[model samples]
Target: MTPVSLWNRSFVLWLVGSAQSRFAAALASIALSFLVLHQTGRAGQMAVTLACALIPNLVMPLAGAWVDRIGLKRPLIGANVVRGLLQLTVGGLALLGQQTGQDVPLWVINGAAFLTGLSSSVASPAAGAALPALVAPADLPRANGMMGSLAETMGLLGTFSGGFLVAAFSPAVAILLDGLSFLLMATLLLGVTLPNRPEGQPTSSSLWQDLRAGLRLMRRSWVLTVMPPLVLLVNAAIGPVLVVTPKLMETLGVGPRGYGLFLAMEGAGMLLIGVLFASLGSRLPLRACTLLGFLLSGVAQACMWLWPTYVPLLAASLVFGLGIGLINTPLGTLLQQGVPAAYLGRVFAVLSAVGAVGMPLTLLLVSPLVDRWPLSLWFGLNAVGLALGGAVWGALMRIEPHIPALAEERSIEQPQPRR
Candidate 1:
């Protein structure tokens, strides 16, 4: 087969559409928060509404199976369309409530949030599953890197702009824009046509069987099994960062604006590192880069713990961002390349679900610790965990020169599941 060009029209369209959808999601998040708070003024109600949005992730294993069964093409388009209409409905309701001096019922908005999240959960994993089909094997690294960068960029853009939009116009206007963006995203994806599923690959007879099969597949691959736990730990470690940043800022006398600049610096590091991964990632040694990223991230966090000053902290944030980019880009590319096409959706979904479990747990454990202990202790703990993860991945990388190839070999050796 002739190698497909990485910059082909289909890939470009997928990239743009994915970015648009992500940006829309971020906008919706901000707009929804505004609308909920505006309507209820109760922090508890706002928390419930946000929690509703996260409820779908608990079912991602099943959702991933559905994605695999449906194939990527239609699901991606349908998800975008559903999200678009849902956001538009929510926005219209918000506007209606505002105009009539009556708030939209809490239950109605919460239901909408849940449905929107359900669709969103599928869209994300499908994007990951669909990428390998859109581009050549060798280009997977660059493709994944670009996609990661685009997502991060859009998220930052949406987060920053969403507040301003709500202030200048209204939350409804910001949400309406979110809806339109999804529709635009759907239009862009309409042009993408994925390859048919390969013949003789394993599938299951029922959802339960399929779910087990997905777990079975993950259990068979060392790479798949290890990555998710690392992801969970890394996420848990970062949770405290968000909690401690305010206190850190106060200690350093940086103020709110300094905190924003600090975040921007980290974002800048992420962006630059992403660009590097897109351009040079394929040529570089994956294990080395991964280890370096982990080391830098851990060291950066530890630096903040040791010296919580303005300049040192800012510099640490940048390096920390670079470390994040390195870890995410390579990890994502490896998964996309290593997993079988038939199981990609399930694998990614399961991985995400596992990590999601840790986030709330981390928050539960870390939030209280922040109030009771010095901020530096939590920061130091995060740094240690990250450094430990780096050491683990480094050892694994050394054991296998080519992790993807190793995964492929192991996958082939495992017997196919019965239909």
Candidate 2:
């Protein structure tokens, strides 16, 4: 079969819309963080607001099932519209408070955050599910890489824009921009076409049944069964690194500027790898690339633990970023290729939820002990986990070929109980 162009109209629209939305989200993230801090004057409240945003991931399974039942376009459009409205409301409230010399209610901000997050949770699976329909399977890796690279670039720009906007105008203005961006994203998505479910073939199974079927299918496939937990492990290991980095930098006397550079190095590495993937496409083997990512991440983390100096730490961070880029693109392609399109929403939702839970849970357990323990301990632990996880993943992939194809899994009409 002839390869389809990666820059087809549907994908280009999706790419631009997604990049703009992500840019807005990154801008809003900074604005929201500073806004809460300025108003509440407490870091605790800021944490609470961020936690509110994450709470919706817990409900992603339900959202995913809904996406599967009703189809993708409506969810994508509706979620963006709702999120746009919510952001605008929050921005309006902040502006009102600014004009009146009063503080916007913390509750209102948190409530808006929660609702917007819920909308995003619904939209995410729908978007992922729609991708297979938008591009040929052979082009998925390049498409995903392009999307990742552009989103990263946009996010970095958005972060800088957020600072500038807040400094030049106000957090309220930046937030309003975010709101408008979402509305624009929704408008753009309206023009993109997706494959529709067959005419007159309505879903026979209840949403709960469909969810169960998704789970059953996952259990039967070695690749699917291993993916969620592996993602969880990687996230869990990485979480403490983020949490402890500031303190470690302080101890090294690098200050905030050095910390920023450290992060920039990582981002630079990821962007470089993303571009490589986009350019090379399927020339790279997914399984080998993923395993190499894990190994690089583990080795990088070990370097951080062993050296703990300014230059070495920066170098390690760059390698870690490259590892992450390698892991994310291939794993995403693996899922898009391995799973039948019918169950894509549910599977992606489950993985997203699992990954979401990992970081917070690990942070909760690790935070209290951070000041008491040596920082190298966290780095060492992360290194070990990544290395072992990679080994286990490689073993699982060996067994994956023996298992029957996930496409053989029954449709929602013929649901099977989990073994």
Candidate 3:
């Protein structure tokens, strides 16, 4: 069979298996993070732990280049295997010490977190870059919509289930489940046979060289110019909200269950919107939808700050999700449609690296401010930040002149590459 037809079948298998595996890991991740904070009562320490987790994202440019050198399937399978082992190790350490009331040491836990983060740095971009081979150009958005929607759904379900597992079985069990899921995901990845990129591209020696190429794409290219930053700004504000919610509840005299309900409600809004986007995303103009999503999310954040009560907060969360779904659904389709398959992974990594910088700083800044500011005020700033991000994208649309909501659609159909 031709690679195209083989990939058609593989795509279906990967989608189903990937979603199922992701569901488990997502639940485990949240459960593990929650366990750390709850058991240690040290939120900052957990933030630092997660900081180590995010560290790989900043360095992913090099990682992506490395993966391209190996086949995409190998890196994916290897990363999953390593991740599964790391999770199992952590779970085992905790298991052996169950009777002593002593848990895994902080450094050990952080190391495991680091490994999981690193695996993601390798796997995510490769999977994204690999999608062009999966289906034809016309089906790209539909495939990407399915991918994004399933991810959102899995994320919501995992988080809720993670919270439940933490409440029911223990964080160790949650971690073990996470490990097994990764193992299963790895097995599935092994089944996929990726194509080798056509040769005679730049043999960039330094990671910095590859990074510069990516930076140039972001600066000069039409599609990436708007997409990544649109994500970054929305991504940046997320950290503060996560921090502020618990603090708000604590100050408001509510318990953890109340906080979970609030978060789940917030997630629920996104869940509904994700389904909506999956259904209608292909019909929307890509650029406009992205720009508007950021704007709406900004408005939602600001509105939440205006009233930190249950109703407004929930409304804001729903709006945030709606905006996110619109922007995120078509993104992979844009890349798969726009970028040459060979260069896609490196470009994805660099964009991710650049975009991740904002989130860590946002997290760092939010952590210090939360202790001093009123929860209402802290969240209000995040809302303002989201709004400003929206404005920037709106301005980009006006200035670029040629770039529009359905620019990708027009570009793909024209038969002439923009460059």
Candidate 4:
């Protein structure tokens, strides 16, 4: 008998399309910053543009609820199409203005960014929810791992190439590439046929009720409550690390090369771990991976405090990256297996919203302290917090009864006729 393969056509296509879209996003992220800086040369103006992009995060929960009602395929496709058009519009207008010796209006650029962000807010959750429809329950971890690796690598490429692309060609060109990527991804996704709700499942409900249902799920699950705060705290630490890492590097007599190397190592570690999980993750216990990941991350941070050096810091970066993969991948699998398909979009939206808020808030709080406090202080504090968070998470895992939602694991194994 032939062995079954998880890399079915639908899964492969989804993976490729999603990776293309992510790469485009990464490129756009870099190009957007450059465009703002080059045009205005004012930090305040850049902030306003950034804020415009981020403000749409407030709509994520509503968008998620809407996705649940409408289902995934249409929403995901439409979002890509809309976002592609928005970027194309911005790039075309900018190019036309340049040729005509007239500047594109600031409002146009900012409005386009805001609209794209809004479109993505809907697409992100829909994509997450759609995955299980394409692959078997047992294959989710491997699929997610592959997806994560592709996204990370593409993002790294985008970051690495963004500045060079801007220098070599116009920002308009970079923006155009980003737009084309989205359109191509949409085209690929159009060919995919995903499973729909099984018969007897009620048709779509009201958005408000869907919203409440999603919220109720969160309220009921101890894991859900634990995730948001833990995510927030960990993300918050990134702000101070960004500010302090450079100073620390200088003290070690290394320049941007060291910084870049550290980032490369981290990305490589994440990619390596993702590949391992893709193959071996099925045998691993989710709870064990989660706890170990948390502990590893905490220990990595503490290493910085215990012995801060160039080599040690590099090693810490690798461990930190591995830890992130362990935490995120298993958590994602758990969520996919646990939630009813209808509620998946909304839950992911809430997760994204928490991250959006947490990341920016961390920057706000830590930016001021960078000049006043030593780098060691931040590292020590983050280390302790991560350790405690891990311990708390482990305790919760032991104490909390099996969540009813997660009992749907077997339901995910049931075969559905393709739509």
Candidate 5:
């Protein structure tokens, strides 16, 4: 297969649009948090508003099935338009409240958050499922890597800008800007062309049946079945580590500056690895990349457990971020290469829903224990679990030849369209 240029028209349009949308999302997140706290004068209300956003994840499977049945482009475009309108509504309400000398109601904000999230549930899977159509299969790793880097860069920039905008103007202004970003993304997407659904593909099946078929595919594949739990474990570990990092920084007498450095190092590491993947990831074996990621993450966690000092912890954070990039980028490629195009949206949705379900549950379970238990113990346990998880995955691959074979079979059986 001839390698496709990464700068191809469709991909460039998608990439630019995605980057701006991600930036808007990050900005909106910070603005929303500040807005809720300012209006309600309570941190708990902020948490509740955040939870409202998460509530839509419960219906992600349905959203995914719907995307698969209809196709990607329209759903992607519609989601952005809807989210933009929702954000505009919130901003308008906030502006009205300011003029009227009354606070925007907490429930209204929360409701908008829920609706925005629901729109994203559709957008997320549609976007992921659209990539294979926009770029060649061999370019998936690089494509995904570029997207990851864009997200991280935009997120960092957006967070900083959001803080400035909220402070200098108002959260309402930042939120209105976010709404504009979404509308811009939708406009850009209108210029890109996506493939129509393949002729003869079944679409009359009920959503439940489509969802069930997606699930059945997951169950049939060993890699699909086990990978989610492995990812969940990693997510579980990362969340608690974030929650406790502030206390850890305090213990080291490093203050907020050091805490910021710690985060910056992690983001820098992720960004570096993303660049590397974009440049050279196509030559690498997916399984080896994934295993190395897990191992590196485990080692980084162990370093955190062994050396409680500020410098070492920062180094560990960097390594952990690199591991995360390694794990996610290749895994995304593996799925895109292996899954049937017809089912891609649903599969991505199921995986996303799993992450959504796992994160809060893990945080809830681990948060209470943090105050009482030694943090090092938590790190040690995660280190062992992550390392063992990698080894176990390797063992599973050795015994189950179907993993690589499945991908090869899919490539041969249903060749991707040449863009």
Candidate 6:
């Protein structure tokens, strides 16, 4: 297949729909928390709302099994529909509260947040399953790179744009925008013409069997197994930084807007790196780049605390963003190309599910430390996380020296020949 022949009319239409959906999702999920806080003026409630979105990740693998069984389009469409309705409900409630001159209870908004998260969980597996069908094996790298870039780009824009929209209009308008975007995307999905479907009924077998199958496949492939952990290991530290960052920034008088700016810069860095990956048109030495990127990330995390001035903090965020971009693109490219199509949804689900476990666990420690310990101590601990991720992934490379994708030059193994 041509490296990019799949870039036809249908694919472009899908991209437009997917981009808008993602933009809307980002606006609601990433930026919506700030809106909730603005309305309620309660930080703890905001955290709980965010946690509702995160907690569903643990159940998403099972959702993946359902996704694979149902095939990509059904689950994708179903999830979008659910999310659209949920957003519309939330927006209407926010409006209702405003009209009645009564506050929307934190519990009420959080309940909406839970449904939003559940729909996102259901949609994730379908998205993974859809990409391979959308493009040929030859174009997997380009396709995945574009995907990564678009996700990060939409996230950055929606996040930054949410603030502007809310400031210009109001949270009600912002959320209504989100609801309409999802509704539109779901409608457009009717025309997508996905390239394939799962072979049979969406399966519901023994839980142990599904979990075992997913794990077995993951363990057998370095790209599936080692790389995710390498990435997750870094995020173990990142979760804390994310949790404490705004607080720290506030303490240092950088203010909330500055904090948002720091996040935006980090996202921009990821977006830039993603574009480079999409268009590079050559095989990157995955192992070398992964190692260097991980190390750079560790170094950047360590330096973030040292940057006393707000300007330096912005620079540090940029480095963190760029490093993340460099590491993740190749890793995702390998996963998409290496994992079997039949198992792709489950494999990615497993990765997302387990990988997310680190963040909350790290959060448990971050709250206590920041409250009692020095900021330097927290930053130092994060640095240790980076070194550990770099060290562990490096060790895995040495041990699994022949891991197919690790060879310096790119050589994509074709999907296993027909049985």
Return the TM-score for each candidate structure. Answer: 0.80, 0.83, 0.85, 0.78, 0.79, 0.84
- Which runs in model 5 stand beyond 4 Å of their true positions? 1-5, 34-47, 92-104, 163-170, 198-200, 236-264, 298-316, 362-392, 401-419
* Candidate 3: count of backbone clashes, pairs at least 3 residues apart or interchain: 1
lDDT of 3 by residue, 1-419 (tens): 12445236678767876787767776666566666766676555656676667777877888877665554787788888988899889887776756677877988988888888888899877877776666666667766767766766776777667666666667787788778888888887666656654242355677566555555544555556765775677567676666556546555654344454555665565566556655775676776876777777767777877888876776677787777665666565666666655567777787676677666677766565656666777566777776776677677666664433222211333343333
Per-residue lDDT tens digits for candidate 1, residues 199-279, read 334655786766667676666555666778887787667765664664466567653345555765666677777778787
Q: Which digits, one per residue and each the tens of the lDDT, describe model 6 over residues 1-419?
A: 12257686556667788778767765664446555656655444454566666667778788877666557777777888887887787777777876897766777777877787788787887777677667778777766667667877887777677656655555666677788898898888887766354542223366545555666656555545666676567666776565456556557775445665777788778888778777872476666667877877777777876764678778878888887877877666666777666667777777776666666555544444555565545666788888888888788777665444221101212222111
Task: Assess candidate 3 and give its lDDT.
Answer: 0.67
Compared with the true structure, what per-residue lDDT tens digits does model 5 show for residues 1-419? 11277678888898898888767766676567667756654444544565567568768888988888888889988999999999999998887887897888888898998898899899988887888888777788888889888876775567556656666667788788789989999999888877556222344458987787777666667788777676666655565565456456656875434555565566666777778878886787777878888888889999999987888998998898788777878888888888877788888998877767655565556645766677666677778878877887788667654544233223333333221
Model 6, C-alpha of 116: deviation from truth (Å): 2.2
Ten-residue stretch with the least lDDT total in model 5? 405-414
The per-residue C-alpha lDDT of model 6 at residue 10 equals 53
Q: Which candidate is the best by lDDT?
A: 2
**Native-referenced Cα lDDT, model 4:** 0.72
Q: lDDT-based ranking, best first?
A: 2, 5, 1, 4, 6, 3
How far does residue 241 in candidate 6 sit from its true spot (Å)? 2.9
Q: For model 3, what is the error of residue 28's alpha carbon versus the real structure, in angstroms, after optimal superposition?
A: 2.1
- Output candidate 6 Cα RMSD: 5.1
Listed per candidate, the RMSD to the true structure in angstroms reads 4.7, 4.0, 4.6, 6.2, 5.4, 5.1
Q: What shift in Å separates residue 123 of candidate 2 from its native position after superposition?
A: 1.1
Of 2 and 6, the candidate ahead on TM-score is 6
For residues 78-125, write the lDDT of model 4, one tens digit per residue: 999999999998888867866897766899988987898788899888
Q: Would you list the C-alpha lDDT of every candidate in the order shown?
A: 0.73, 0.78, 0.67, 0.72, 0.74, 0.67
lDDT score of model 1? 0.73
Q: Candidate 5, overall lDDT?
A: 0.74
